[model samples]
Structure formats: structure tokens, C-alpha cells
Target: MTSPYAQQGFRVGFDWGPAGAAAVPGSIVAVVDVLSFTTAVTVAVDLGIDVYPYRWRDETAVAYAEQLDAVLAVGRSQEGITLSPASIRQAQGVRRLVLPSPNGSTISQQLSDSGSTVLAVSLRNTSAAADWVAARLTADPSLTVVAIAAGERWTDGSLRPAVEDLWGAGAFVAGLADRGVGPLSPEARAAAAAYREVAGELPEVLHECAGGRELAAYGFAGDVVVAAEVDISGLVPVLQGSRLSESSKPSRFCPVT
Candidate 1:
């Protein structure tokens, strides 16, 4: 059997605990902040900069950025900033903010300590990331690309899968499936597509979703819409540590959804 990262081209599966604990050291972790962090990372990539996930929102981030040749500081909150490219340009450390918030970066942080090359991907840049993977895994097509869906939070010895996040992942799987790329298992394809079929409103799609309901109650309709765009930019945000930026390939565009 192939090692997990061997399967992902960088081992690291997408669960919080032991199931994913195997994902450490030399793995390529794709942090999926479908709601916000991933989008923030995408915004940074659109500007043509690289970012790293922060170990701590408090000092480590600032300290790390301080060490970079060029650094930016970014933080995410449900209450601040517009995801629009224009607004992203105007935001503080839009290029390099120490992400410490409710969405994507938190997951990025989890894989930070791991030596894996962490990459932030979404529906918009799913193909870019996938193509990158395909190229690298040409020698090891069995590479495991774990799609971390930012799902529902709970305490029942089980965490729930967020509908919107999973839906996005399904679109990603479908896109890759269409191309017959990577270790995108049938289970992954089904997981992402199964949820894509059910629909009402964006919020309705994410209804019962641990995070989406919260996003709905807080009036993030615009965000939900942005998160669901099938293949908007073809940009994938690969994580260095505290800030995120484009992968090795910037102009390489592919369609996964």
C-alpha cells in the first residue's frame, strides 16, 4: 500500500484528530477554507504574492513575517472586509496578514508544524491546484490529495460535514474526475457531488451545516455566492506558513468543476 502522502504527493489526510494524524512531514496539505480563509489566500494570490500559515495569531505571526524578505499581515473575521478583489487590495496585510479567525487559516495552522507543502485551494482555483498535483504526481500518480472540507463543528465524538464545503469539494472532485486525475477516490467524487444536487438558497444548501447556518444568520449571502462560483479564477493558493500565495505555476489554468 502507498503511504498517504505518497498517495497525495504530500501526505496528510483531512480530519482533525488521529484519522488525519498520519498527515505530517513532507505531505502536501491543501487547506480548504471554502468559506473565508481559502478566499483570503486566493485574494493574496491574485495579487501575486506568497503566504505562510501562522503558528500563533498572537506573536509568532508577526515574528515570522518580520523575518521574511517581504511580508504582509492578514487576519480573518466574519465582521470585517469585503472579499471583492478591490476590497482585498485595500485591506491590511491583504498580501500577508497573520490569519487568526473563524475560517480557513485555522486549518492552515494545523498543518503548519508538519513539513508538508500546504496549499490553499477552492472551487475557483481547484484546477490549478489539481494540475500542479498532476504534474508532480506524474511519477507518482497515486499521490493522495486530501481535500479538507471546512465542515460542521460538534462534540458527539464526531464532526459533521458542512454541506457547502463538501459541495465545493465535490465540484473539485468532479472537475478532477472529468480529467481522470489524482487519487480522487470514488468516495470523494460521491461526497462532493452528492451534496451538489441538493439546493434551495446558498444558505439553504449549507443549512444544518455547522458553519453555513452561522454564516446565513449573520447575513453572508454575498460570501456564499462567491464561495460557490464553479471555476472563477483558476488560481490555487499554496501555503508557505503564515501567508499564502500562488503555487509554482501562476499562468497554468485548468478546469476541475
Candidate 2:
């Protein structure tokens, strides 16, 4: 019995939230959190810092950082650098950064043991990420890819499908299709359409989305800009164990066997 997902040529898929992520059957998972988490990771990795993804800002995170001898990042209001990409871009003397976030980090941690090749992505490296994933799929045609948008949490703790993340994921979906990697599922197709709809107005669209507006109101609008910059980096952050580090080689797929 062939699965409908594969029947639809869904070697690629896109959906939002942890629940949506859990439903993804792809062997390669890319988590997108444009508002911050993954965005900060992109910046930090570009600066040659390794990022440890933790699900929360609790004692475990502090202990984890201590064990790794890395600095634990705080919230935006704290003294040191937080999840804000702008702050991370300006930070110095940090070899490794332990970043905790409710969405991206949680997804990263949850998928760590799922045996899938997990990848971290944001708009900052959307095109590069697409290329990286394409290489993997090219090497192993049996593997599928899923781009999961780690949407924000609403006031009632429900998942809010963020437009920025949708755009980010869509960009990857579109880029993959452009590269002729393989056929895309309806879900992936819709994300690509959504991305094409707003590709020309990314910065302004980021400024206007609900998540973007919230960050702007909190005086972190520049972070949104950082997230809106597409293809500014060629680095791809890959998850090995529980940490995200720069891909040793971005042009080829290094499968975990």
C-alpha cells in the first residue's frame, strides 16, 4: 500500500508548529523559526560559534552550558545577549552559545533522537539551506525533506502560524523546486506559492506580520530585518546530537550512517 504523501510526490513537505512537525514523515527535517531562535543560530554559526539548542531557559540549560563550557544566552531584556540576532551579530568572545527557545530549540531537541538528519534554518540562509538539502536528496533519492515552521505561541499557548516562518519555509520549498530536486507535495507547493507572493516585499512583510509587529513593539525590529535578509550567508547549520554547528561542507550531503 503506497502512502498518499509519497503518492503525491511529497518528497518535500511544509507545515507549522510542533504538532505539524510531529506529523512530518520526511527523513530530513529543517526547523524554521524566523522570529528568533534559528535566526540567532544562523548569525552565531556564521560568526564561528556553535549553538546548543535547549527547549527552555531553566536550570537544565544553565547546567548544560556549564558542562559544555559555553555561555548561556538570556532573554532580550537581560544583561547579555539573548535570542535576538542583532545582539548575537554584535557579540564577541563567544566560542559556543547555548540558546534556549520555546519553539525552534524544542523542535530541534525533540527531533534529535528521531534518527532524521535535522537542519536549522531561517531567512538569513534560506537559499543556502535549500541547496544543502537538495544535495542530500540528490545523494539519497530515497530520503524526503520536511521544512517545519516553528510558529510562535499565542496568549492562550496555542500555536500561531507565523507569516515569517511560512515565508522562510516557503522560500526553501520554492528553491528546492527550482533546483529540480524532485516533485513537491501540495503542502510544499502552497508554501512556495506563499513565498513567491511576498518575496519582493520581504522586509516590509516581516515588519507587518504579527510576530514581526510584536518584536518591533518590543524594540527588536532590527532583528526582524536580520531575519528578512535572504541568502546573506552561505553557511548551513546542521544538528549532530543536540547541538547545531556549521556544516563541514555545504556543497555535499554528509549522511549519518
Evaluated with lDDT, which candidate comes out highest? Answer: 2
Model 2 per-residue lDDT tens digits across residues 216-254: 899999998898888898999998766788888332222
> Quick one: how many clashes does candidate 2 have?
0
**TM-score for predicted model 2 compared with the true structure:** 0.93
**Span of 10 residues, lowest total lDDT, candidate 1:** 248-257
The TM-scores of all predictions, comma-separated, are: 0.68, 0.93
RMSD of each: 6.6, 3.6
Error of 2 at 40 (Å): 0.6
lDDT of model 2 at position 149: 92
Q: Give the Cα-based TM-score of candidate 1 against the true structure.
A: 0.68
